[model samples]
Target: MSDSLTLIEEMLGREARLFAASNVESDDRSHRTYIVADFEYQYHRSAHAGYQVAEGAAAEEKIRWPFHRIVAAAWTVLRFVPGQAVPEIEAPVVLTAETMDEKTMVTQFFDALAAMPQAIFATWGGEAKDLAALRRAAVEHDLCLPVQLLDLSPYSIRRLDLCNASSVMAASVHLPEYAAALAIPSKPSPRKEIGQLVENRQWDLVADQVAADVLTTCVIAIGHLKSMAVVTCDRPATIMALAEKAAETFPKSIFCSRSFRPWARDRLRAAGLRGTVFRAP
Candidate 1:
């Protein structure tokens, strides 16, 4: 792997993903996948040049969704089985493609998700942004999309928007703020101008941003699971150890990758984790 790729892989996580930390009591609760995901897209600057968007109204209409091209996506999979302390967490696998070849990116993303048993797709505010972009991309590419991705109903069980779920659509709250409030470790002022980065084809930086965002959301999802009593831990150290145990099982290439030591040290921190190191048996 090139230096940039190595850096990204190290940041992304080991192998495919890690584990889900769920609270289902049903017989079918054997396995549930918490797929936290985020996508970055580039839009037609030629079409919207010099156009300022109105915040409250017409914002949706002003930013034409049809011109969107999904350039990159970060998929974080967390697989949790009842009675298991940690669900296999496939935190993030970054995918990148040219705007014209968006079909390939879209295809691989959903195809991989489809292959996962009992996947629940998630995003920050994907219902309005990511999902719509995907639907439009599918239309343009003539691809069959999963109904779960297309469904926007609040009653829909398969897709979840963490932003809406946690805040009830409070205008001031976003993923970063939510992470901060929860004491989730985040580098202050991470770059979020993903569209700009995507336009420049800076996929490495894009991956950096997207991957970290997915990680934050995954932790948040774990927080939700804890609140619902799906996952019971004596404290943050317990969660940390389980996550480390899961990471230790990953392939050697990723297992020995850089940044993992520090990455592991920081997680489930401030938000509820005490950073207790877990010793493997």
Candidate 2:
């Protein structure tokens, strides 16, 4: 194993020892783990594209993101002894407002989240509007919003911007610098002009671009951990296909593309995380 992997294993092993000591088990190790579910508003954009509801109505409605479902679903495939399961973690929720006035979308998310008794909602780029919306919605709705913040900025393995063309510009300028530091090739292309494309309202292209980001980001997020799940707002078909391919390539690694509802339950089962563990095996 690489030094990085070895160091990581040692850290996780230390934690596992503690975990096993606290539970009733022969070995102080568990297959269950936590992962950060990085939510992005994929369905929000889809609803706008399909005319299911006017953009105005969609903003007000508490619509679920499809990618959340995929994340939850993927959890069903993995199973292990449960004891405050340690293998799953999700990214902080990430949402982009289609319009400045649609801060209500953020509010709705937290309000719904607060309704859950025991919950962990992750976020990416959770500052500013995302955090603001969460606060406002949680307060106004009189809900208990339990959130553990996962900052994505510091640990960003790679970044893909789907909302606007600015991401292209940023990537073009930033990636080259990054590659040079790593002694890799630096290539620039006309597509680097993100501002212009966004101005043209190229929604499909935008989704495709962000989808690529979601895939890349999720892969990187899970790569470092011994066990993990990467929740995303990517379309189910796309996410599942990737996970399937990954499973084929890496038989030992478990990947799932499920929604939060079903997947969360699976997580509970696989991790044996229903309640607190008073003792370890």
Candidate 3:
């Protein structure tokens, strides 16, 4: 493994072992794991063109889900263990490369998720957009998908669509709006710019945007869980503090790319965050 990946593994080491133990026998303690996922995709011109050429005037690929190709997929692990003030948020992880094709990128993204199928996969627009797009991409590439993701019901134990889970406050609002309600820092480059970034091979920016989405989804999930009493944790004030800590720690950090720092740090400073973020070796 690369040094960076090794570090991430180390960061997750204790939870990794505990997860193994939980499988063999229930510890009789309350614990849960969530993989907050999000991704950035570019509209596939080829698919658009194929529709245009085949149907002439009838072709309209300007806005279609199947034509969207995954460019960056990002996630962060949240370990909701007892005896902790709040869920332990893992360092945000992103899968993307400027040179990687959609096939390889989607493959790696699913491979990572397949490694932890039982973990609850949470997202803002996950059901309607992210996973749907993934399913289409897998078909296009003949890639094997984890059954955990393919047929997940919203109420299924394996998946939760924050976007649609709630009655009004959640399903009716957008991801950014929900995040703003929770006071989380979620602003990144506009979604419209993703295509140009891909065209310019600006994978870092795309990755950052996806990572920010993942983080926002995670924090919002925590907030939602707290409201539902599904997971117990610290008070609202304390949880918000830890969420900010995660914002500072990830997106732009000591161990990974800083391409996100200039944009993210300014928001941090505006929010009055100072000092370097400490990560254990």
Candidate 4:
């Protein structure tokens, strides 16, 4: 096999082992699945220019740049059976199409998610950016959005925006910053860099970066939902100090709820600690 193929196989193997060794219990009764995803898109500069022209060159230009096309998307789906300690983590899925067929890529990505059973889609800033852009793109392209993505109820748990959630709790909301604060590894590529790759028509590299973002988001969600510790303190400074210390002392095991939960049950198991070690606040 070519070296590139070998490397891909090795990476897949490593991810498989990581999932297999997770502290997965067989008691899952919720019968729900989770999809953690991220999307990368480019602005429609021409559309903006057209709007400016149509308004006779004097109308106030809309500052909100519409992401009318989806350049790339990546997601990781986890099947959570109620009562199970660890959900089944699927391999990362990435989609990046040629410029002419970008909408088709978006459709296919959503279609895959729609086909899944009882899935909940989660993203860090998806509500403000990714999902909104996707809905608009789907309409512009005359493609139908999956029901899972179309539901807009404020209380719906089917779609989760971690950034929004953090904002509600008045905590740090940026994904990369939050991940860093929680000791999750940084993204493989910077967000600004993806635009340059898109400009250069490097879809493969863009896909790779998006995949890394998706995986990082998935890990963060897992840590947030399953392993984060809730510590109560009278002073905000004390909370910050505790969070920093936990992240530094137990990069993989302990996570603070103040910055967002850092410790997952799997992390505790990996650290050879009992679940009871984390006391409820």
Candidate 5:
């Protein structure tokens, strides 16, 4: 392992030990593990030229359509011991294509995710973008998606999309912006510029960005869980009332906007209420 990875593992271990020591009541509790993941893709107009032309479109129109190709993927598993305040962190895992081949990169990405079975996989905007793109890419590449991700269910706990949760709670759904709002550290490489780096063959930079994104995702998820555990409310109606009051009190604040919805949903879910749908009064 790289020195950085080793150091991260040490840090996680230290945190785990400290948590155990502080929460002695949970010493004998059993825990489940969940994986937090993020993926970065490069979109190129050249890859879809043939498909575009086949649809009877002019050459100029064909250039407008781009194909999204998975270039990097990163994930980390968290140990969720029952009665613990937060999950135990683990060193992140990253996958990238050495040759910049989409098929190889996509295959490896899915394979890594598939390796972790029975573990909840979480991501930011994964359902609408990351996983959706992956599903399409896997089909194009003739690759089989993991069963956990392929299951089409409204309440599939196997994969949690933090972005969707944020949307449900009416919070800012943008990953970097949301992370910033939560005071999480910034990524080494900005996600917006990653595609340019990929085009320039800066694999190292891409890997660094992916690593940072995945770690940030894990941190955000932990924060979400922690926040949910501390909420005291009777029903979604009460939470919505409080949200409206906050909005009226602080019009320019994120807490007063749609961004508050996801946070509210997270708390509601933690309170054993079904938070998948948000009903407005």
Candidate 6:
């Protein structure tokens, strides 16, 4: 196999192993749900532009700082799940309720997703409009979506967003800075605005993002099975908040790609682990 393929496989393998080993049981005796995930999308086009700042040194600093808090919220929720009756661990669900224009589709999609208790996830590209539509959809469908929503603006909150992880992973292989860090190839330069580059219309990029996000969610669930706490979110502020809280309670909270690393080294170490890693096999 080519070196490129080999390297990709290696990175994937390492990540899988790390996630597999993360399974540990919490002190509670309730049945562990492993993982529960939700997706966020912006309804106002202006809000979508904020994510564009995610390109340079600005992007790195932006992500490195406050985003921990956003991830922390997800952690906070997961930490308390034993006391609450979270929705069943159904098949994964995806929602795209970013604007009023998408009302018809969002309504239909919400109906379909609500029926799938095993899995449900969704995304939107605007802020107020998108969130409003989602609220309506939830109410109309007799579901509740009153949880905290992730807003990418204000630059104060940080979200450990995985929406761009596949691109980052793919680009790291070829870009000089990320390539060297990841020990991979540099990507060819692109000739489009950041907005244009991330247009969902580019089906290929969208698919990669969705796959990466879903995989991250699954890995997180596996960790939950081990009794380790799991947190998730789509906005930087929420992630930063979650991570910050986790850091206080756990010793080694780490934020990389879209998911997080265990903070406590001693809590329920390796409790529900089925294997040493996760893969399609």
Error of 5 at 136 (Å): 1.9
Model 1: runs farther than 4 Å from truth? 1-27, 47-62, 98-100, 187-192, 231-281
TM-score ranking of the models: 3, 1, 4, 5, 2, 6
List TM-scores for all candidates, in order: 0.69, 0.31, 0.72, 0.66, 0.62, 0.29
Q: On lDDT, who's better, 2 or 4?
A: 4
Q: lDDT of all the models against the reference?
A: 0.62, 0.33, 0.68, 0.60, 0.61, 0.32
Off by over 4 Å in 3: 1-29, 152-154, 167-171, 235-281
Top lDDT hit: 3
| lDDT tens digits, residue span 29-82, model 3 | 367777888888777787688789989888774668888888888777777877
lDDT of 4 by residue, 68-168 (tens): 56778777676654544455556556677665466777777777765652467888878777777877787788776665565677435567777776667
Show how many residue pairs clash in every candidate, following the order shown: 13, 48, 0, 14, 9, 66
Error of 6 at 30 (Å): 4.9
Which candidate number has the best TM-score? 3
lDDT of 2: 0.33
Better of 1 and 2 by TM-score: 1
Better of 1 and 2 by lDDT: 1
What TM-score does candidate 3 get on C-alpha atoms? 0.72
Candidate 5 residue runs with Cα over 4 Å from true position: 1-30, 56-66, 83-88, 169-172, 230-281
lDDT of 6 by residue, 188-212 (tens): 2231321243344443332223323
Residues forming the 10-long window of minimal summed lDDT in candidate 3: 254-263
Across 192-217, the per-residue lDDT of candidate 1 in tens digits comes to 56667777787666656666666667
Model 5 worst lDDT run, 10 consecutive residues = 230-239
